[model samples]
Every structure is written in structure tokens, then in C-alpha cells.
Target: MNGVLKALALPVVLFTGWWVLSADSESFYAPPLSQILTAFGDTWTLEQLKADVLPSLLRLFAGFLLAALIGVAAGVAIGSSRRLRAVTEPVLEFFRAIPPPVLVPVIMLFAGIGDAMKVIVIVFGCVWPILLNTVEGVRAVDSVVLETARSYGVTGTARITRVILPSASPQIATGLRQALSIAIILMVISEMFAASNGLGFTIVQFQRSFAIPEMWSGIILLGLLGFGLSLLFRLAERRALRWYEGLRAAQRSS
Candidate 1:
């Protein structure tokens, strides 16, 4: 309870400050927070959420899950083999150096301006962090642990599943956290281009139509969505890493 209050304290304070400061403001571009909140309530109805928000979320999860799967698999393979890592390092670096947004047009040419394109864009942006982190995590696994597992005849899939993946999960989680932010950013960016019905498209539409309050509301919704997803991710991470946390706690006590 205290932790939750502490976590919310800054946001509550900031929002209260905004409400007080913007109460008597006459700025068109920056309307009162009350007006924005009203618009948020009015604009984001169930139907609107179904039409715009749901699709975006579906694409986001799809891309993020695919990226996680591919990243972990490839990372494990590359990390397990020194020669493969050496050969692929330069290629990985080169691709990772290129900004994902720049590849939007190229991806569109191949994938068309559909949900597939948007999903691909998100995957492209998100995959690198997960892959790189997983690789590093795998490489950083204690050699002693590997030797012990080997001595126990934990070879092949058993070695990877029982020894490697668990050892590397912390770093993989770090990568996933990073990728999630990227996924959200890319999701919006992708929707902004050649899209018709999504949060990004609707936000752009509201902006172009001079619906300032509505646009502000959409922005707020996006922020809230990101926050909610992040909170959920942290919860899942804590659950997934309970064993790791316990180990660390034991070490500290010892």
C-alpha cells in the first residue's frame, strides 16, 4: 500500500498542478485539463475503443511476441557458438544501426500498407534489443554453471532449457522491457503512415480537423495505455523472476 501510494504520488501531484494552473487558461492549443478530461470521456467511447484501440493493441502484441520468440531463439543459437557470433556480429550491428522508421517505406513496398506492414515495422524495431540482450545474457552465464550442468549429463535441449534459458532470463526481461517501449512508439509511427482506423490515425485526424481537445485526449489515452502495459509487464516480470529474486535475497543475507 505504501509502495503504491509512493508510486502514484508524483503523478497525482503533477496532475493536480496542471488542473490548478490550466483552470483559467484561454489557450487554444493547450486547453484546460478539465476540458481535455471531458473530451477524453466523451471521445473514447466503447465503440471508438473497439474501432481504434483494439486493432493497435492486437498488432502490438503480435509484433512483440514474434520479436521475443525470434530474438530468444536466434540469440541462443548465436551465443552458443563463437564462430556464428563472430560472423553475424557485423551484420547485426549494421542493421541495428539503421533506424527502423526509415525502413517503413521499404517494408511497405514489400508488405503493402496493411496491418502486416505495421506489425513488421514494430517487430523490426523491437527485435534488436531483445536479441542483443539475450545474446549478452547467454554469453554472461557462469561457465561454472555450464560445467556443472555438463557434468550431470545435461546436454542438448536439457542443457539449454534447464541451464541456459533460466540463467539468461533476467537479461532477456531487460531486453523485453526495452522492446515494449520501442513497440509502442513504432506502433504509433506505423499507424501514422498509410492507415485508416487506429489510435494514431484518429489522433492525426483530430489534429488535422482542429479537434484540439480530442487530440489531447488521444495523447492522454496513449500515455495511459503505455503506463498500463508497463505496469502489467513489471508485474509479470516480478512473478517470472521470483526465483531469481529469492536467490539474490539469500545471497545478501548470507
Candidate 2:
């Protein structure tokens, strides 16, 4: 309860302040909170949700999942072998340095302004953190564990599945958490660049038309969406890393 209250306190304070400050305001750009909420309630109908929200979520999930799979696989391969890591480190760094938004136009040229381009953009943006973290996690695994697994005749997939992945899961989870925010940002940026339908496009459309309240509503919805995804990810991470967390706690207690 205390934790919940602490979490709610800031939002409550901010909302109250916003309500009070905008109560008698007449700013065109910054519509009153009540008006924004009203517009939000009105514009976010079932159909709009299906059309805009669903597509954005689909792209987000599809791209993120792809990034996760590829990142983990590549990270494992590179991390487990010193030669491979040496060979790939510079290339990875170079690519990772490039801003994802810069690739949107180039990707669009190749993939066109379609779902493929958007997913590609998101995947490109999200893959680096997961890949880098997984590499670090794998490299950091205790050498004793690897030797033990090898002595037991464990090889290839068995070793990776039973030892490496489990040992590195905590770091992988961290990477995924980092990637989530990047994925969301890329999702919005991609839509803003060249798109017909999405939360980003909708917000931009409203802003262009000077529908200030509706634009604010879209922005609010995006923030809420990010918060909800974050909560869900945290819940999943807690479940997935339960053993790792328990081990740490035990060590601390000792």
C-alpha cells in the first residue's frame, strides 16, 4: 500500500497542479486538462483503438520480438568465442552508433513506406541494447560453470540452453527493458516520418489541424501506453528472474 501510494503521489500532485493552473486559462496550444480528457474520451472510441492503437502495438511487438531473438542468438555466438567477438566488436559499435531515425528514409527507399519498413526501423533501434547486454552477460559467466558443463559432456545447444542462457538471463532481461523504451520511441518516430495511420500520425494530424485537445489526448494516451508496457515488462522480469533474484538475496543475507 505504501509503495502504491508513493507511486501515485507524484502523478496526483502533477494532475492537481495542472487542473488548477489551467482552470481559467485560454492557451490555444495547451488546452485545459479537463478538455484534453474529454477529447480523449471522445476520440478514443473502439474503432479508433482498433485502427490506430492496434497497428502500433502490432508493429511494436513484432519488431521487438524479432530483435530479441536475433540479438540473443548473435550475442551468444559472439560472446562465447573470443575470436568472433574481436572480429565483430568494431562493426557492432559502428552500427550501434548510427541513429535509428536516420535509417528510416533509407529503409523506406528499400522497403517502401509499409509495415515492413516500420518493423525494420523498430528492430534496428531495439536490437543493440539486447545484443550488447547479452554479450556482456555471457562473457561475465563464471568459467567454472562452463568447465563443469563441458566435463559433463554437455556441448552445443545443451550447454547453451542449460548453462549460458540461464546464467545470462538477468542481463538479458535488463537489455529487453532498455529496448522497450527505444522500441516505443522508434514506433512513434517511424509513424511521424511517413505514415497514414498510427498514434504518432494521429497526434501529428491533430497538431497540424490545431486540434489541441485531441493532440494532447493522443500524447497522454502514448504516455499511458508506455507506462502500461513498462509495468507488464517489470512483472515478467520479476517472474523470469525470480531464481537469480533469490540467489542474490541469499548471498546478501549471508
Candidate 3:
């Protein structure tokens, strides 16, 4: 309860300030907070949610998941082999330097303005952080630990599951957290161009049509959605890294 309240304090204060500041605004572009909230409630119906919000969320999840899988897998391979890592480092850096949005047009040409294109854009944007972090994590694993695993006859899949993955999990979690925000940004950007059935598209539509309050509402929804996802990601990270946390606690106590 305390944590929830603390988390909400800033948003509550900001909302209160916004309400007071805009209470008497007469500008068409800057409607009162009350009007914006009213429009938010009125326009974002169940059907509208199904048509716009759900698809965007689905694409976000799909792209993020794909990025996570590929990043971790490739990171592990490259991290485990010095030759492979050396060979790929320049290529990885080159690709990572390119912005994800810039690739949308090229991806659209190949993927043809579909969900595939959006997901590809998101994955391209998100994968670099995760892959790089995971590589660093793997490389940072203690040599003694690797030797111990090897001595115990742990090889191949068993070694990865029992030794490598656990050791690098903390850094992997960090990468995932970073990638999630990137994924959300890419999701919206991908939807902005050549899209008709997403929250981003809806917001753009409202803006072009001069539905200011509705556009504001969509922006609010996006902020809330990002906040909610961050909260959920943190929860999952805590749960997944419980063992790592316990170890750190023990070390601190010592």
C-alpha cells in the first residue's frame, strides 16, 4: 500500500496541477482537464479499445518477445566464443548505430505495411540493448565458476541452464528493462507510418481531425500503458531475480 501510494504521488500531484491550471482554459487546442478526462471516458469505449488499443499491445508484446529470444540466444553464442564475438563486434556495432525508425521504410517495402513490419521495427530497436548487455554479462562470469561447472561434467545445455544463464541473469534483466521502453517507443513510431488500426494511428487521426481532447486522451492512455508495463516488468524482474537478490543481500551482510 505504501509503495503504491508513493508511486502514485507524483501523478496525483501533476493531475491536480493540470486540473487547476487548465480549469478555465478556453483554447480549442488546450481544453480543460475535466473536458479531456470526460472525452477520455466517453471516447475510449470497449469497442474502440478492441479495435485500437489491443492490436497495439499485441504487436508490442510480439516484437518484444521475439527480440528477447533472439538477443539472448545470439548474445550467449557470441559471448561464449571469443572468435565469434570478435568477428561480429563490428557488424553488431554498425547495425546498432542505425536508428530503428529509419529502417521502417525499408522494412515496409519488404513487409508491406502489416503487423510484420511493425514487429520487425520494434525488434530491431529493442534487440541491441538486450544483446549487448547479455554479452557483457556472459563475459563477466567468473572463470572459477566456469571451471567448476566444467569439472562437474556440466556441458552444453546443462551448462547454460545451470551455470551461464544464472550467472548472467542480473545483467540480462537490466537489458530487458531497457529494451522494454525502447520497444514501446518503436511500437508507436512503427504504427505512425502506414498504419490504420492502432493507438498511435488513432491518436494521429484525432489530431488531424482536430479532436484535441480525444488526442489528449489517447496520449494519456499511452502514458498509463507505459507506466503499467514498467510496473509489471519490475515485478517480473524481482521475481525472476529473487535468488540473485538474496545472494547480494548475503554479500552485503558479510
Candidate 4:
């Protein structure tokens, strides 16, 4: 109850203040809070929301999941192999520096204006942070732990699955959290570029038609969608990092 109150109080206060002030504002930039809320409510008919939001969410998830799998795998390989790391580190850093939006036209050339291109762009944007973090996590694991596992005839798949990967999971979780944020950003960008049915497309459509309220609604919905996905990722991270929590507890006690 205390924690909940602490969390809710600031937002409640700020929102109420905004709604009250904006209720009387004459500036075109300052739409009434009620008007914004009403726009949000009216535009979000179940059918329309389902038609737009779901496609955007599906693309986000598909690309993010694929990136996580491949990134983690490649990160582990690179982290463990000096030669591979040497070969790929510069390339990874190079691509990571380039903005993902720039890849849209290049990806379009190869994949066209399709789901593949959207997913590809998302993966390109999201994977580097995750892959890099995974490498750091793997490399940072305690050498004693690695040697102890080796003493028990544990190496290869068993080493990774039972020891290295588990030890790296908290960092991986952190990376995934970052990746989720990037994924949402790229998802909207990709939709705006080439999509027919997503929140981004709707926002563009309403903007072009000069439907300001509806455009505001799409923007608000995108924010809510991003917030919801972030909350879910945080919850999953808490669950997945239980062992890491225990380790922290032990360290603090000592």
C-alpha cells in the first residue's frame, strides 16, 4: 500500500494539475485534457484498435524475439572466442554507430515495403545493444566459477547453459529491457515508413488529413503501448533474475 501510494501520488497530482490548467488554456498547442481524453476514447473503438495496435505489437514482438535469440547466441560465441571477437568487434561497433532509420531505404531495396523489412529494421536497431551487453555479461562472469565448472567436466553446451548463461542472465535481462525500448521506437518508425495498418500509419493518416485530435490519440496510444510493454519486460526481468537477487543478498549480508 505504501509503495503503491508513493508510485501513484506524483502522477495523480501532475495529471490533475495539467488537466485543470489545460482546461482553460486558449493556446492551440494546449488542447483541453478532457478533449484529449475524449479523443483517445472515441478513436479507440475495439475494432479499430484491434485492427491497428495488434499488427504493430505483433511486428515489435516478432522482431525483438528474433533479435534476442540470434544476438544472444552470437554474443556468447564472440565473448568466448578471442579470434571471432577480434574479427567482428569493429564491424559490430561500426554498424552500431549507424542510425537504424538510415537502414530503412537499404532494407527496402532488399526486402521491399513488407513485414520482412519492418522486422529487419527493428532487429538491426535492437540487436546491437543486446548482443553487446550479452558479451559484456559473459566476459564479466567470475573466472573461479568457470574453472569450477570445468573441473566438473562441464564445457561447451553444458558450460553455457548451466553456468555462463545463467550467470549472464541479469545482464541479458537488462539488455532485453533496453532492446524492448529500441524495438518500440523502430516499430513506430518502420510503420510510419511503409505500413498500411498500425498506430504509426494511423498517426500519419490523421496528420495528413489535419485531424489533430485523432493524431493526438494515436500518439497517446503509442505511448501507452510502449509503457505497457516496458512494464511487462520489467516484471519478467524480476522473475528471471531471482538468482541474481539472491547473490546480491548474499553479498550484502557478507
lDDT per residue for candidate 1 within 198-243, as digits (tens), equals 8999999999999999999999899989988987898899899999
Off by over 4 Å in 3: none
Residue-by-residue lDDT tens digits, candidate 3, 143-187: 999999899999999999889989999999999999999988898
- Provide the lowest-lDDT 10-residue window in model 4: 1-10
Q: Model 2, range 1-254, lDDT digits (tens) per residue?
A: 46446666887898899999998878888878999999999999999999999999999999999999999999999999999999999999999999999989899999999899999999999999999999999999999999999999999899999999999999999999999999999999999978999999999999999999999999989998997798779878888888988999999999
lDDT of each: 0.95, 0.94, 0.95, 0.87
Report the lDDT tens digits of candidate 4 across residue range 1-254. Answer: 46446655866788799798888877654578788889888899999988998888889999999999988999999988889999999999999999999989999999999889999999999899889999999999999999999999998899999998998888888888899999999999999886789888899998899777788778878877876677667667777887778889999999
Looking at candidate 1, what is the lDDT of residue 165? 99
Error of 2 at 243 (Å): 0.7
- Spell out the clash pairs found in candidate 2: none
At residue 220, give the lDDT of candidate 2. 88
Best-to-worst ranking by lDDT? 1, 3, 2, 4
What value does the lDDT take at residue 134 in candidate 4? 95
Q: lDDT for model 3, please.
A: 0.95
In model 1, the runs with Cα more than 4 Å from the true position are 1-3
